[model samples]
Target: MYLRLMYLSSLINIILSFNITDYLYRYEYFDQSETTTTKLESALIKFQEFYNLQVDGTLNNDTIELMSRPRCGVSENPSEFYTYGNKWTKNQLFWYFAMADATMLKIANRVFDIWQNYTNLNFIYSIKNPDIIISFSDNIFVHKNNPRCMKGECLFPFDGKSGVLAHAFAPRQNKCIEIHLDKGEDWYIGFNKTPLAQTSLFKVLLHEVGHTLGIKHSSDPTSIMYAFYSENTDHLSKDDIEAIQYLYGKRKESSTTNTSTTTPASTTPATNTTNETNKTKEIKLDLCDIWTNKF
Candidate 1:
């Protein structure tokens, strides 16, 4: 597979949470081939399309930088991620979403977008039963209604120094995904934070969203899900993109989601032109894929 995204060398220091050597372990007994690499390349292109960037897999740092900008909603504070306490009155997961800020809305859209890219999965967020919930104050957050982690994970989206950016629960067997909103209190919904002279909110959101969609962290430094968040880095690495498309490509049984009479279902069709010929059919994409880059 051709690594389409552009790549730029960086002086930024990154610490790895997961060892790169593990991939070598997977590669040792695992079948590694251009076919797999191409699959990875395909995933990257899907993400590029989601972010409205050029469909290149070269890990272009410039493109990643551009990707950090607002795609879903504009922010007043515009910084990377922040840490704030999740001071909520109720224990219900939906309470956090009720108080979602512009940053949170953008993050939600990004999450939806990644899921939308995989046509076969056809997963959509039910505003009637939204899959993600967020409790944000500064960078720390508590989430619930998670498919896997049941009680939800306690996390920080942007704890300074790239120590801990964020985390997410896996897609549940019910075929739904649970993503929690987390960031620092000082972190801007946009890029207003002091450290983000150059960085992206959407970039981090995209990465976390990828995790919700089943993308594991990648060894490719350029990948959005790389263990470390780099300064001025945005956009999914070629490997990151490939990982998503391939994983979600399998068709799960059709699932119908109920929408609130007030909110109504958000029916976003897929953007994969390859499937356009089957006009009578529908392809589901992550809401992030359909609308984030526009914001």
Candidate 2:
């Protein structure tokens, strides 16, 4: 009897958790039951289904373990993975745009600064064919059935009314990244308290930039990369930082390299061949269809 009571309490805690409870509500689990075995089982089943886990409706070890894993807003399409491998090859990447208002541009620069502070990669402001472009628009879809952007294209569109707050494309060679902000949505400049309906510009841009840097969403609720946006005070969680590091690697110490005064030796043919091979190994990604596969 004591063991059973303890189990019920544990179940209650899990059900009440923000992430789990939010998901349950989405599936129409309105009943607020603390100890009801049936309700708990049903909720667990729905949770498992959403995650593509084994739907036994029981809180098995696998379910619990999966709950702890990081998930991305982007779907794990196998073919897409093959095409847009991951990570940027160069350290200095440029972000170009004048589409947003002055206020938004200021905030965006701050976001860029934060990302650069944490990683070796940099987001330089440029006008001449930037690697990423920041733009704003509304009514992205012409018809409900057809989306303006296709698969593997780096153009991201945001219709404010659409459930999607914002979306971004992973890195691609041929196409430059285009991050779109929904013009209809109310965007807050700073951390001032705002209603649930209004979205924070800084937070959204930070997450989108993560996508551009080849980061998937994290399952950890505290992570900025999580599918849902929250009003958390922290800009980047440990998981979020780790995810970027996995792609670009940890920020290295800056030191100037001394140029060799003696450049008399010519490069061997074998050395040149190896250098060419390394450059050719660059991975290409098709971000055209990425917005359609959002989680």
Candidate 3:
């Protein structure tokens, strides 16, 4: 009787701990119809691989911790991995801030400039007939109350302070691209402060701008487009530059304008003046002490 009771207790514990299936389903890792054990394991493995976690196909402590960390509301499934359906056809894209503080707007502009430095795209700030619109919601209920969120325009409703930071829609012809941030999060501008509970507006906006450009979440954790939010990263990684450039060719260089340099399509000696200036810019941006454990 004692042995039977112990076995039953262990089984109960295992069943209770297997709570990640719902998360898997929500993130497009699992289909409702294919919830068999083999399928579940497959989904777990896929998720682990994307996040560079151990591929044991089990809901380990590290996996649970990662899930608990705040991330973008965008789905990390393979179906929409690198680039979403179509890239924007035009080179010049206009953006408008439907809702944002002056600080947020400034940081957003910087983020847009960073992206344009590496891609053949120009982002113009305008309120009239904007291609992309950005806004913030106080909470999930703001969607039901706001008219702009109606007619399939709303993103997955944000989950309070720290679960989901923000989300953005990919480019669609004639449809305004939307990027919604969670106002509940404590947003900050600079990277000088360490161990801050605040989310970096620059990082989040940079990631969402990638989405608006029709680039999807990157599996590389070092990339700004990584689904999960981390303060450790400030600039774009090689994967991020490659993914964006793949969609919109490299920015055309002008003799008078200094622009950020990206990874070349082929290996070349870094002896050019342009490359030296870009290297200097990157070094300046890395002056902050990155608090990796905060996330």
Candidate 4:
């Protein structure tokens, strides 16, 4: 009877802890009843899912071990990774623009899901506004007379066809990113045949967005940010979240000191009210599309 009661109590605690790591900061006072074998298994799964750890239900030494540890795995890598050419292939050229197909939507959702699990940061996506945009010029190698690609501030890291695929601006810009659109179609993956595992342009673009958002490559092998992207690659690692959040700052109470942008909020005091009201209507483009389009 005592064992059954204990089991019952643990079951209640387990159900209540559908989201274990969400309360990571409050684990100090978490009810002990919630730490039973079954309950622990459930919580551990949450932990595993969040970190992409082994998902075995059994709370073996590996699982039991990380639970007691503070999460410092977020900030391991900081370098960028890219394709060898830094230029797009034939496949991308045939398509002109990388359309938002099922694969793109799937990748976007996967990005959201991973971020939701790892961080508390806000990702404001727009319905009418594509998450990214691309810019292509006719000239190659020189920005001097190349299409819009040469215009000062056209987009960083892309000098027309200068071997730089595309450059995603820092997220703080809150605007569209640039990609060289006219690349070969051969660079793209199957015509929507398989899942997101393969090393397609869609996959590369997805990974690059992580870089633009401040996620550095990970030492962990399973990560999308790993040095060499592959077909079977999974989502971001806990390290990826750590790196990204570090760049954008973490979940903290709102403060005025850090709230303001470089241009003071009072710059256009007379027109400020009008601009603020109009801000809602402005649609921002996505970084992935812009950068990948160039490449």
Candidate 5:
């Protein structure tokens, strides 16, 4: 009996080690080539340091819990230095929805407004030749002709429901800026009424939009740019504000007047075009029913 219990304990440790290693590799803590024991510990330590967790180089309960939480698909920076040296040269940027409904459009407008409130940048809704394009999909196939999937045939395909809620591309010269949300997620619009299992479209959009503007993930958990999603956080933290301002100087005093309005842009209905049309309809029926009833 004693030997059996010891064997079970060893099995559990092995499983936990595998999970931690996969998590580190997935989030860019380290590369697959450097999969030695020391490298794994170092990567774990780096991840802990980023989240302000105790750096004991061990997979404690806290680390495992944090790892399981929903987070942006974008990988966290491996270094202390923030900002990827990528920023839009133009102040006026046009964005369009390749796949979204009226409700989603409204939420996006509010998100863009939040960013505009801080920087000199301006976001406009355009139907054609938009600088940023947003979409919802369960699986993103790589198109060799497409710059967005430059790395390979499949760039971080969505794994359904929880793990990665969304991901976006930073500004790049001659490359398209894109944001893709997992259609499988139970996405709610507002802060007050979000169900425990549902993700706030507002918060996710707020974070992805930051990425569209070339803002990288922040180590500060309070910041919207933080890799992991937090239900309690509704607005940008100081780190978020500073990061945006650093890329594009603060909003001018005269421009303090709120020019952008939360007007829903005419966008392609998600149910009308994508392969996930049926799924999108089901999501709207379930979530929007509650949304309409509340307001």
Candidate 6:
């Protein structure tokens, strides 16, 4: 069944000037396929459900435009099994560095701290085997059994050549929770200081870590878990906080909290794109086909 789908997709790609593979790699939202059958149709339906799109399987202008948008690594496939069960069983989680430099480690710690500040969930750094493993790899095919990854790739390579940023696995189910970053990208500590720069390290990790905690992407563009990266995004939106809290109840209030980060009011902003078709092309983060790339 998979081989048949691939052959048909290959033929369709040859006929079309636009590369659907590249689109899927960047977004990592829906399964990328050329054949317009039920497989593609079902994937599209899942995409619409994940993003609150109208559920027509046929590709429309809106679906295509949304695909062009930036997003996180969590695949929209509803069938994938994830083990984020019963509110984590405990509030504490230990993490390890599979491979990281000083800079990546620093930013990773900061990301963990940021998440901790909001919820009762706590992240502790460990040298031993950890529940969550973080690493940077130029090798796209590294992890195949990672169930958290969605399937697809662009004809143009992902590394420094194209848009895939990074991806992560859902927690509890895998032997070790994992986050794989594309080594091809030039990463910066904070926001992109210049237009010619690479992806933001802090922002990208925040999105991926959310996946490790069982939180999925939200339809809200301002959400940290939104499938794409938005320039204005700096802090977690109310939706992000609410979703995480929903999984594991709200954080207990503390005195003398950190003042550097300001929490947004619980109300969500009204300016995000509605169900209507979006005409603008979105610059999105890209990822690899974890299984296919390995083979």
> By TM-score, who's the top model here?
5
lDDT of 4: 0.38
Question: What C-alpha lDDT values do all the predictions have?
Answer: 0.39, 0.54, 0.69, 0.38, 0.73, 0.57
Which structure among the candidates has the greatest lDDT?
Answer: 5
Clash count, candidate 4: 26
Candidate 6: worst-modelled 10 consecutive residues by lDDT? 264-273
Q: What tens-digit string does per-residue lDDT give for candidate 1 at 44-158? A: 4544444456779534554444333222111111112221111112111221133343334444544444545442444333333444433332344344443333443343233
Lowest summed-lDDT stretch of 10 residues in model 4?
267-276
TM-score of each: 0.43, 0.56, 0.75, 0.36, 0.79, 0.62
The list of candidate 4 runs beyond 4 A from truth reads 1-99, 127-167, 172-175, 179-182, 185-198, 218-221, 248-295
lDDT of 3 by residue, 139-182 (tens): 54233222233343354787666778999888887656678888
Model 5 Cα lDDT, one tens digit per residue, 138-221: 676442233332344347788777778899888976555678888778777543557655788888999999998988888888
CA displacement after TM-score superposition, residue 127 of candidate 3 (Å): 0.9
Model 5 lDDT-worst window of ten: 273-282
lDDT of 1: 0.39
Residue by residue across 105-179, what tens digits does model 6's lDDT show? 555667877777777787776544466766665544444233443334312223332245677876664346667
Query: Looking at candidate 2, what is the lDDT of residue 172?
Result: 74
Model 5: CA > 4 A from native? 1-18, 142-154, 257-295
lDDT, residue 212, model 6:
86
Separately for all candidates shown, the number of backbone clashes (residues 3 or more apart, or on different chains) is 65, 15, 0, 26, 0, 12
Give per-residue CA lDDT, model 2, range 132-168, as digits (tens): 7655545552211112223332333443332346666
lDDT of 4 by residue, 1-295 (tens): 8746644554554455434433332322124445666665665555455445688865554544344322211222122232111222111111112334333333344444454444444433332233334223332422322232224534222222112233343232323333332231223332243332112545455555565455544546566665333555656666666665554445445421221111111111110011102111223355553442342
TM-score (C-alpha, index-matched) for candidate 3: 0.75
